[model samples]
Target chain A: MPLEAPVEVMLAASAGNVLVWVVWVVAALALLSSGIAVVLFTNPFYSALSLIGNLASLAVLYLLLSGEFVAGAQVIVYAGAIVIMFVFVLAYLGGRADAPWAGGPTLQAAAAVVAAAAIALEVIVVIALAAGDQLSDTAEVTGAFGSPAEIGDLFLSDHLLAFEATSIVLLVAAVGGVILGSAMPQRSKAGAD
Target chain B: MLGPGIAAYLILSVVLFATGAFGVLIRRSPLIILLALELMLNAGNLALIAFSRQLGNGDGQIFALTVMVVAAAEAVLGLGLIVAVSRKRVELDVDKLTTLSG
Candidate 1:
């Protein structure tokens, strides 16, 4: 009975499971396509728009990963707040589209693609050969797993130090951003001209 | 346990990260670079959450949370610099911003 338990978990099927599977596949596809759109789009504004879609799909994927609280945070923080900042900055900067790899070292672009593909291939091969079957089992979680209350408990207990550190990091980043924004010398009539 | 396993999620992560890296390497604009950087970070987040699910723990989720904060900070600073560069009426290309004494 114990020996067959793992196989049962592996092959488990149900209506809810089927729904989750469908959502996972849809989100995964959206994740990949939007990611490509972010990279391949020459228009930075459109890329920013795709970034929103990309992050939104990632949030959905997070939900499938059992990251309930983090999934919400992903939507609110990354998808909402960060992307809005990107859009605002793009607008303020009036970023006209620029061609990527425009007049650059032709070989460098090729090398970049090759190198990235090599890295992905390397990791996938390692996963497939070494730990593919063994790592397929998802850990059984408690009912309260990934809930905000549970995460907050963690923040106030086990992860208190790191939690506090993140606040400090955000504070420092805010101050640094302000300083950096004004650090440049203005040509008296810079934007006006 | 439904259909795809952790491997599927991880492979997706790898592809996302590689696409981001390729963009970063080839893109000239800082804005595009930052967007690519987000792609890379999300790839990392997806992997973290996948592992968290596989391991059935909140630790990876917390780590992912921290990563999100760091990412927000990075975006703020990067955009601030971009704004500063533009206010100076300087061309906004990372490759061209080689001089410090400008």
Candidate 2:
């Protein structure tokens, strides 16, 4: 009974527990708000804006998780490139803001819940399996979370084929994009007037 | 240590993926759907990195890199087609773009 009656010990544990709760609450709120914005906005520009905010928040989450490389990639490729492309396309293909054609608000929400459930289940299974057994001792390493040099070395070595294939894929995509983009109708000189 | 960890990262990714999936399913604009699809792919990237950290394996990071490259390529080509389609009809609405509607 004496061992369990330590006031100092309880105070320290409660402090730590409260801190964790606060952080988790904030992260959850940001993520959820962005998700709602993605749906609630009818204008495509606003939707793209919401998406950019979501990506930025996710990048912060990646950093908090000690994923420096991933955070960088999330910012550069996603926030920088992908969102910019989306904005550009929306601008280039100008149209008046019209009512969203997405039918049945209730149906959309229902489908979202089902899909979220499936993704959550898969994640739970993976985490459970991982916790049950020692898959690898790497995560336990003290300095393992943000090792960019090691990541770079592994990228050029063990994953060489994927790297090369990705380059090829990009090249083909660029060529195809150019050809297809150029083929779009040019307003005939006489028709323009 | 109330710092965020892999579990927090995972839950956030799941939420992002769900948002993207919802957008794809409900949005009638092809361009908006494409943007949402990118969001979903990004959610996958976050997971790959989280799992890579969990397993202490570099494979997840490598896979994520490949995915980014592929996503960029897809965006370029996909948008090109979208431009062509829009020019012909000035309709970004998915229902009208369908030439094969039965």
**The candidate that achieves the highest lDDT relative to the unseen native structure:** 1
Q: What is the lDDT of candidate 2?
A: 0.72
Clashing residue pairs for model 1: none
TM-score of each: 0.89, 0.78
Per-residue accuracy of model 2 over A45-129 as CA lDDT, tens digit each = 8877887777777666665555677678877987788778878888898734534444555666577668766776776677657
Considering summed lDDT, which 10 consecutive residues are worst modelled in model 2 chain A? A132-141
> Candidate 2, which segments miss by more than 4 Å at Cα?
A1-28, A95-138, A142-145, A184-193, B1-5
Which candidate ranks first by DockQ, i.e. highest? 1
Worst 10 residues of 2 chain B by lDDT: B1-10
Q: Model 2, B8-36: lDDT tens per residue?
A: 66767776777777777667778777877
CAPRI-style docking class of model 1 based on DockQ = medium
Instruction: Report the poorest 10 consecutive residues by lDDT, candidate 1 chain A.
Output: A183-192
lDDT scores of the candidates, listed in order: 0.88, 0.72
lDDT of 1 by residue, B1-102 (tens): 455788889999999999999899888899999999999999999988888888888889889999999999999999898897787678998888888746
